[model samples]
Target chain A: MSVQDDLETVEWDVSEDAHITVDNEQCITCEDKPCLHLCPAECFDYQEDQEGGIYFAYEPCVECGACMVFCANDPDKGAVSWSKAEGGKGVEFDFG
Target chain B: MTDVAFDVVVVGAGRAGVAAAYKLADEGFEVALVERAKQPGMKNVTGGVLYGSILDDLVPEFPEEAPLERHVVEHNIKLLHGDAEVSIGYRDLELREEPNYTLILGKFDRWFVDRAVEKGVTFLSETTVQDVTQEESRAVVHTDRENGDIACDAVIGADGVNTTVGRKTGIQRTMRNEDMALSVKKVIDVGRKTIDQRFNLDSDEGAAYIYTGFPQGAATIGYFIYTFDEYISVGAVGGLETLRWLGDEGYGETGTPLYSLLEDFMELDNVRPYVQGDAVEEYQGILVPEHSYDTLPDRHDRRVALVGDAAGLVLNKGYTFRGLDYGIKSGLVAAEAVMECAEDGDWDAFGRRYDTSLEDSYVLQDMKQHRHLPKFLKNERMYDAYPGIATETLRRMYSAETDASGLTWRQAYRAFRRSDAGVLDLLKDGYRGLRSL
Candidate 1:
């Protein structure tokens, strides 16, 4: 493998269930959403879906739990659940 | 079993293992160093600050050949409260001269391993040590994914924080939840010009910043910015217990996860400007043992010895982030003990000597000295009240208000005492700080 290719495969085996999931219904319509503002991986996204409701995706999540800690509304209580992804899955950084 | 014994066998060719192998080989001892990774540093992760004193000790004139990033010239501490920030910092040209602290170590493990190989230490890469078969006189290290068992008089386990050798030999217990700090880091590819300008550093000079207080809260959160050749490494670390505490308390509004906290920290108006044109090249998360004096495990068994993170020797004070240095130093000490035992022909005496050396060394002393500091940092007021007070006080002092308000510095201080802390609480905290330090 090329040096770059070899570097690309230095994957960390994250659990399959290791990710942060958010319940859109529980999102409070606040002027400033701290979760959207604070995530290091830019995992949280806000957009108008086809039906006009705000759509959110956390595909790039690193599972650091900053949103759950800073969430003004209680997300961990009911709105969001954070858990380790299935073993050998999640974002793998080659250069880190 | 065929007789293929070496004077010493060091497992896991990370910083600690490499250092020990180098020292022993240089001292004319037959050493066999084994690594499970494809290369020396393939499985290693470091915050990437090569502290000057340790490097100077290992190789007195190291700068000429070391893969150094930049000589650090500035150090900053930021206390964040909501949207406001209180910063205390120092910049000196002296730190950029000879014996200067350098932001290096991307290829440090490989370089160190090469040095050991040069000194006649056999480098065995892509070899995994399955278990140690202990006999009365010597230990035979069994290997899978490799050919045969290699016997050695003594073994040194430097296999980072999540050590398999330490666990298999029962030299130390598995790390508890509170004893480990989960850290995530990223290398953002901001060009050299952008990095120099954004961090206010000159050519070949770098800056480092540490943050505490709001956003990070009572948790031990530290963000470091180190200059690479063409990128900047930004990273944060927090205790797992504190992370669990925050999760239970229900904090984020939009359901921010712990790993994403770094993004939030970087996106802050205060931090965003530095990386305006940068692109993230990598992101990684690793566990760091907090090196609490209480959590230190006994160093030796009948034939095995634990060194580096296996013995729980990571030090993370607010001002200094040192792990590689401790790892190297402990490995050197362990090697010396093993060498002493080889001379005396007493394995039991060797094990005792290793433990005694650790207790007498500066590594153990430093950990014991700062034993109480970690608990003091866990205090919520230090993150919440102190940062809020300091920031508000600075704001009032610097405010360009035309209105002639009769607020003296003392009165301004009292107004900023809007924190939940009272005089007695402050006094008790003061005492704790003094005692801990």
Candidate 2:
């Protein structure tokens, strides 16, 4: 099954304001976009439009904070900014 | 828009935060337990076996009353390379007499919080702690709500691996890629009778399986399956730094996708059968600390003390992964120190007492003893070479149709030598493994 199908089983109280924002300006200059590959919920993507942009959706984010350590923490590149959703807004693990 | 005050404020109502809140409230200190989730553990996930013995001090009747799934009496460790497998299985009735249980954290956390609330802890659900600062004589916790600053004598930051408290307080700076493991997990339901028949268990007995060396290109990634009554928890854990290194060396075409890895792990020849017909109940992901104990952040800053994953107290020793126990233990230790300060009216010494007392406790000692494990877990041979040696050696010895006739130890030795590693490499790894465990 696809990641979207798998994520469908999880319950989420998605916030209208995205908790994670990706700067495609930095993404256009970046060599390796680890966020696309590392996110467990598959919330990041490489948008291959004419500009070669980066796409991010916070609705399915598990709040694992991997982007904070891998992408955001890099001194040279600030492509990602991550934070937990507002209180009570985010995926709720029924069986965690 | 009214300001509130408490004797202590425990941030994040997971195991550590609740333990501290419960203890402080039991000791007649007004405590506030803040949780960002609608309920405690809603954001928590674990491929876990909660060792319940440590809870005796906090809740003596936990085993009988807590919302536990099953008492585990069996453990199976498997190393897989392709279709070949090398495994060790241990089952003991005496283990059931102890308090090892496989459980759902979402349910367990809510139950534990209720007990803490019974001890007079004010349960502040749906409230996120934005920042924490220590002023002259009080610690101020700023929340997302307007006029939500809560003044307390001390703040316990048990916010978890992606800790806002740790970052805002500046006690923990950057968590490197190498210092954490990202896990993608699923909970599958397969009925209690099926669990008993497939795992060879009684009504209350459960099994845990740890699988290593099979997700082809991902480094330091392991798979685990734990039984919880009618639900089975399956997941894959990989160190982010090692995974990046493998990607740099061109392991996969691109960086490893953790969700796909979990899917691949479930499809493995050895793993597929157990979960084949199960219905997916929930899918979750979490970041756990894989850093050495020495690399863990400072546990306290003035009146704020970090606990559990916020303090990086998790440990992975290849054979076992422990965080819940350490989280609870450290929370109790921090609360004890808080109680000591209450008696002496010297809250300024909270940090010193917590450090010294924890240094003297088994929690820090156990972590210090296994400090070498995180790096050892990143060793390449652990994923590629070692499982190959074991699988190849046993395969050669067990094939009766071959010329060697399945009855030769010498042939096993020959098979072992034909694999990637040398005897010297084995000895070095053996020594390192011994020291790490």
Best by TM-score: 2
Question: What are the runs in model 1 whose C-alpha is more than 4 Å off?
Answer: A1-96, B1-3, B97-104, B247-256, B401-409
TM-score of each: 0.80, 0.96
Q: Number of the top candidate by lDDT? A: 2
Query: What DockQ do the predictions score, one after another?
Result: 0.08, 0.64
Q: On residues B1-437, what C-alpha lDDT tens digit does candidate 1 reach at each position?
A: 63467878888887778888888898888899977665666556667466656657767756777666788777788888888888889898877674454443437667778878998999887666767756788877765533458888888888767665776787776455466776777677888888777887776887777877647365686676677767887777777545544533223332324455666777889877865543556665566787568767666776777788777788877766767778878898988897888787897666678888988988888888888877787788888887777766666667776333556676456654687777887898889888777
Error of 1 at B228 (Å): 1.5
| Tens-digit per-residue lDDT, B314-401, candidate 2 | 8887777888888998899899989999998888888778878888888789888998877787777887787787666666666665
Report the lDDT tens digits of candidate 1 across residue range A20-74.
6666665544433444444444455566551223245555554444444344224
- Which pairs clash in the backbone of model 2? none
